[model samples]
Target: MLSYATIGVTDLNKSEAFYTELLAPIGAKTLMKMDRIIFIGKSMKEPMLAICIPFNKEEQHCGNGNMIAIAPGSIEKCDELYNKAIELGATCDGAPGQRIPDLFYGAYFRDFDGNKIAFNHFG
Candidate 1:
């Protein structure tokens, strides 16, 4: 039921670079860009993930218990994407592995802005 999600950042250039690499393995590309925000998705019309400077012109911070989960299509893809994320400077929250035997496999990390993100597959 979700349509899109956004996270606030202090540095738009840094956030853009980080997310461009983080989302590349999943084939998500830039869908739009405005002065202080950018939207990315598999297609322009699909659900998007946006990174932006806080509209209120205040400091940006990560939410206490919020995360963005990305499905990379399969267990292997999830692992690959997770590795790529780390290589591009994301800090690991959880390594890629089966989280629920034969049911869920996933990996977690925090972006440069400390926003949590995940890649997972369900079987």
Candidate 2:
């Protein structure tokens, strides 16, 4: 039901570096780039995440209840990406662990621009 999701960023280049490195462990890479935006994903056919400067020429602010969750495939990945995100300057929203008794494992963080992201695994 989703073609892509976009998050506003103040600096495209900085956001690109943070996302590319943080997502590399899961095989996602830069798929395309336009004037003030960049799309990243495993491939063009898959859902992509776009980071860009807002077209309205206003400041970017993260929405209170907005977040993007990425399924990284395993618990180990959840931890790996969470740690990697921290190493790359993201602030921790939550640490990697079981959120549901035996169903969900996830980690959460806020990017440099304060967009919330989740590295998740659901069984």
Candidate 3:
């Protein structure tokens, strides 16, 4: 139902670096770039996640109930990505673990721009 999602960032370069590392484990790469935006995806033809400066020219801010979730293949991968995120300056919102035993295993963190993101695996 969703074609793509975009997150607002104040610093493109900094947000780019943060996302590059964060999305690597999930196999998403920088698929394209423009003056103030970067698109990420597993392939050029797939749905993308974009990071951009607000088009209205206002300061960027995270939304109260917005989040982006990624499935990185396994619970272990979820943990790995979560660790890598913290190493790259992300703040932990939740550590990697099973939130619903045998059903959901995930980790949550806030990106450099304070956008909430999650890495998870489900059985």
lDDT string, candidate 1, 1-123, tens digits: 667899998888887887777788778878789998999888766778999999999899899999999887999898888888898888999999999999999899998789999999999
**C-alpha lDDT of residue 104 in model 1:** 94
Ranking by TM-score: 2, 1, 3
lDDT of 3 by residue, 50-106 (tens): 999999999998989899988888888889899999999999998889999899998
CA shift of 122, model 3, Å: 1.4
TM-score leader:
2
Better of 1 and 3 by TM-score: 1
List residue ranges in candidate 3 displaced over 4 A: none
- The prediction achieving the highest lDDT against the true structure is 2
Q: Write down the TM-score of every candidate.
A: 0.94, 0.97, 0.93
Clashing residue pairs in candidate 1, if any?
A: none
lDDT of 2 by residue, 24-94 (tens): 98898899999889999999888889999999989999999999999988899889899999999999998
Better of 2 and 3 by TM-score: 2
Model 1 worst lDDT window (10 residues): 17-26
| True lDDT of residue 2, candidate 3 | 59
The list of candidate 2 runs beyond 4 A from truth reads none
lDDT of 2 at 54: 96
